[model samples]
Target: MVEHQRRPGWAEVEDFLSATLVQGGTEMAAVIESIDAAGMPRIEVAPTAGKLLMLLVRIQGARRVLEIGTLAGFSTIWLARGMPDGGHVTTCEYLPEHAAVARRNLDVAGVGSMVDIRVGAALDTLPTLLGGEPYDFVFIDADKSNNVNYLKWALKLTRPGSVIVMDNVIWEGTILDPDADPDAGAIRAALEFMGASPLLDATAIQTAGSKGWDGFAIAVVRQGSATLGE
Candidate 1:
């Protein structure tokens, strides 16, 4: 395993960007507070990243969003807020306790009604959504080991032109050496799957922030693409 380096300025700039453009406001703050209160891992996306998710949802004109993680409902709030009046977000969380905290946070954020919190492994929960309307956007931010599995599910649950975003792809540059860790190996496999899949056009970007050096991959289902695992 390689040591990850962080410059003091990265987080400073992130805070500045959050205050200037992200402006998450009180609801986001309360979500963060709730996570702390529940002793949950503070692994929610950065404010800028959360805002980006919101913008992506809006830009995609997504009425239905599927999220593989619901940590304190921080990102879930952003995803829900981006949708139109009747938009819905379905999020899966493995831990019941984490889901409980997220439930309170989502309700407090005033977007609880727009969100469906599925408490279980995402692989199991995702299967239940198979026959529903296809999601317009999908966000995968859960356990790294199942990234490709989540991507496979995303392909199954989304239509052509639907967008999918996977977080923590860079993983402090550990992806350059998949043998570094189990998570790194899985991330590498997921990226490889995305790159080689004929049904998608995808790209990834590296980012530096309070979360250290990490990044995300974004992909769009190809027009006339055949749905996988049909």
Candidate 2:
């Protein structure tokens, strides 16, 4: 079953935090600078989303985490911070410059050892990762055009009960309309896949704020061999 909830914009909260907490943190400031230097879009997760991901990781006792996008390592820092003592996160970023910035940010965060930033197209990198092991949490935030493909690959690499969280699922409300463009269509297809998959119990929550009109789709893999949509 699929469920959803809409909340006040998250940007306001993020703005407030940016002004108060993150404003004077040298390391965080440096990370932001690195992101800016990379020229890649530095779209970090909303504060609430970051906290929620951390909580989910801890709750699931996740030892292995997979992230499809590492845009200057903001989300990577959050994920790494949530891991258990020996837990690790493997994140993929296609842009070399962006990956370098992310590496620097992660290093400054003091969680560098806990994160592995792989530089390559996620489509090519994900398959190679499959042979290594299963992940307890998979965060997808890469190219929207390949969301469906990513979901398929994620499903195969995650064990039952693993959580898969897709960022930008709403695509600024474009997916809500019948006249969605190509990117929105790709997101819609991913949503349909999640809604129809019997192997997952999923929900979509709409959020607003500094991040604009976007949202996340979270799917928890069900136990046993049941298919999705069953």
TM-score of each: 0.96, 0.87
> For model 1, how does the per-residue alpha-carbon lDDT over 1-230 read when each residue is reduced to its tens digit?
98888755989999999999999989999988888888888999999999999999999999999999987889999999999999999999999999999998888889999999999989888999998999999999999999999999999999999999999999999998999799999999999999999989999999998999999999999999888985
- List runs of model 1 lying over 4 Å from the truth: 1-8
Instruction: For candidate 2, give the lDDT of residue 10.
Output: 63
Model 2, 1-230: lDDT tens digits are 76776754566677787576544346656777786776666687765677677778888899999999988887788788778999999999998888888888889889899999889899888877756768999999989889988888888888898999999988788897736588898899999988988878899998777778889999998899532220
Candidate 2 Cα deviation (angstroms), residue 167? 0.6
